[model samples]
Target: MPVEARYALLYSDYEVTPCLRIPFEKFAFLILTLPLCAFIFCIIYSVLFHFESATSTHCHVYNVLPSISAAIGNFSPQREVWQTAIMLQSVPRFYIAVIYLQFHHAMAYPRDAWMGNFAFLLNVTENISLIILSFWTSSRHYTVHEKAFITFILMSEFHMLLTCIMQSRFKRHNRRSLKWKRRLFLTNVSCIILGAYCYMRHNSLCEPYMYSLFAFAEYVVVLTNMAFHTTAYFDFENKDFVLYKYGAAITER
Candidate 1:
């Protein structure tokens, strides 16, 4: 959200960065959104894992449906475990959206540190998702696949929040040097750590195919965000970071 707000300010002809003509804009953005749409679909799929639960999850989902569809696509969560499993992604993602918005607009004003604070609570939001899902699933034993999927997403969100904070701190360093090797190393390291954690947490569980796809999407997005940061001059070294990064920042604008 902050990124969108910033893009509005920065790219608007009336604003800071002014405008630059981008080529193949439509195709490029569609490609970028495809991964995000997949990630979102994975979340909706998780919600489907839990069809019977204490809370309907359906009500909230129904109410939020149009908005979600507008943001991503038509994917919806139908089952209780799916509803429960999905919260692992949906809840923390809300924070990510808000923080991204807050950060984007924050450039126009420094007081938007609220984004940072919101980011710190990522673990809490994720845990809350876990608690709700666990309680719901415990009512009826969840599949090992569901359990592992939940574990992977929860861990990814926790780690993504860490990456957000770390990246923000790098920006604070003034230069925010663009070193693909450095960035890729850190991101891959994050992936390895998250994979290892998931392995440790659910060694007995059967890994879901959906979760593998989700992990792949998340890995790609980490690289995408780096590309985004490079374009925003949120990083120092000017490289030809893929234009797809700007697509994300531009969406909510």
Candidate 2:
């Protein structure tokens, strides 16, 4: 069958399903704002404890801008603050995974296409990997932490790639506003490239600046991921998911 016909059948099935649908705006807000706030809090928390006059001499000046993971490690004297910041960050990640899965459902892509389902899977996997890395301090579980970090990066990139592909196929009316999507895609790709370079420089050359450079790259990656979700605001501005009340008829708002 033609792609349009397949999409039509899938959408028809979605229309009859008795599940509650949420507004994409809600998801977009969760995806974009929460993470931004959480990261900002984490950065501030990290910077404050890192530069304390009491600890600065023992911790070294370079330690002031340690990798985000290092800043949030369990060994910090401010472990509680760092852990709290990490937990706050994780909330948005969890919500992002949920929103991506919900988005896949809302799109009603055919099973055969599989891109939507796979994108959700990758997104969830990325979140899980990050969660693992967050709690499993690198000082104690270096190998596991490193593996989880790498896995998160790989899965996140794959998730974004699939998202870009799927978004490109949006109905004609929605595709026009996706110019920003292309720019975001490029930004993501550039971050990955720059991040890889910085990582290599830090590991191979032991360059002092490369450590901070890599950390900044990681921050950019997170920001770009958040930006990717912002594109949905344009695509779903007018459409909303219907919420079904328990023991009551479904109604669209």
Candidate 3:
């Protein structure tokens, strides 16, 4: 799609998906307001601890920590990282919604050509879980109880990046079938084991060791996932360009 044409979604006459053609008037309002909504979600999420600080006198076992523990829940530098992560997280969800609207259009018009709605759904679910994990790990006690979650996040990161690489490299092939999904599940479980190792050797009692390790592991995970997915996207768009150019609409697995 042309750059102008892609942005023309707010005013264009193209079909929302392969199916139903949508008027810009119908979705323009929602689409126009999404950035605002994402901003709000980030603001609220960033200050969740600050929001709770007024009520946290108990200092439960989960709140042991040295000094930063008292500040983890606030909008400090530590909190800012999650603010960014959670906000970026919304991009995938927004894309998911765009695909969903197209799905609705396709059902209405009966001409949609996008493949693997299930795969798209899986993609959305993974991103949602990822964002949640990011926020949860920001908690002061998250390391104590759920360090394993980071391992799972790393596992998914590698899995999705590899999946994207595979898809991009072999666009004409059917690669992610039953065996692939099983392999993914097994690999993800192993990630949890890596987390266990990290925890057993943990130095969480220190000033910033806890957050440093947590952030380090998560930074690598997010960067790898995002970069691979972004590259795969261009590959996908290019493939779609070719398919559209050649009038090749039907694909079967």
Candidate 4:
């Protein structure tokens, strides 16, 4: 029997009336848009009012734009706004990660399910790391923030790569979602490389706008990461999140 068939059979005894139903695409859109807007707002706020503080580096020179850490981690309204946006999105993202795990398990072979599970673990870890880094600013708790940031980056990259590999193994999966995910993943990798290079050169030579270029690269990395996740919208476009009351089954003689 197929996975869906088995799932239906196992739950046939329960009374499954949806108390709440939400389309995954809309959920995805709201969550992604929140952070994007927050990021932009923080950047603008930093540039407009806190220009010297936002753009100042350890070398006491000003870049064109602030690094994400400086923009959202060091300021007043920016920090609060960023924290709020991330907090709002975090729960939904966790739910989505669980849904993706179930999706992979249902669609993939038994042996391949392990990869899905690992990817799911990575996704959860990445989310947790985001929370840690977001709440613990580098300026305040440098050690915690630095560690969380590193973990978030590592987990995110691995999770995306594994998700793509797992989906590619399925011949009948959504080609459009897979294609776009692969492209976004490549873009993210490119941004990472560019960001690293710019960061290195900035520290070594403190060239004009070098740190700004690194900051811009970091922005692209974030955008691409979010875009890659938004592909989940296509994957689960037709799906609805249904909630059922427990122990509500009825039988008539």
Q: By TM-score, who's the top model here?
A: 4
- Estimate the TM-score of every prediction: 0.26, 0.69, 0.40, 0.90
- Local accuracy by lDDT, each model: 0.39, 0.61, 0.39, 0.83
Residue pairs in clash, model 2: none
lDDT (tens digit, per residue) of candidate 3 on 20-130: 223323233343244334434434453464534512333222322222223333346544554464565476345533443342333322332233343454466566665
Best-first order by TM-score: 4, 2, 3, 1
Ten contiguous residues with the weakest lDDT in model 4: 244-253
- Give me the runs in candidate 1 sitting further than 4 Å from their true place: 1-28, 49-181, 204-253
Q: Is candidate 2 or candidate 4 better by lDDT?
A: 4
Backbone clashes (count) for model 1: 18
lDDT of 4 by residue, 41-95 (tens): 9999999999998899877666789999999999999999999999999987886
Relative to the true structure, candidate 1 has a C-alpha RMSD (angstroms) of: 16.4
Summed backbone clashes in each candidate are: 18, 0, 3, 0
* TM-score pick, better of 1 and 3: 3
Better of 2 and 3 by lDDT: 2
Question: Candidate 4 regions off by >4 Å?
Answer: 1-15, 243-253
- The per-prediction CA RMSD against the true structure, in angstroms, equals 16.4, 6.3, 11.6, 4.6
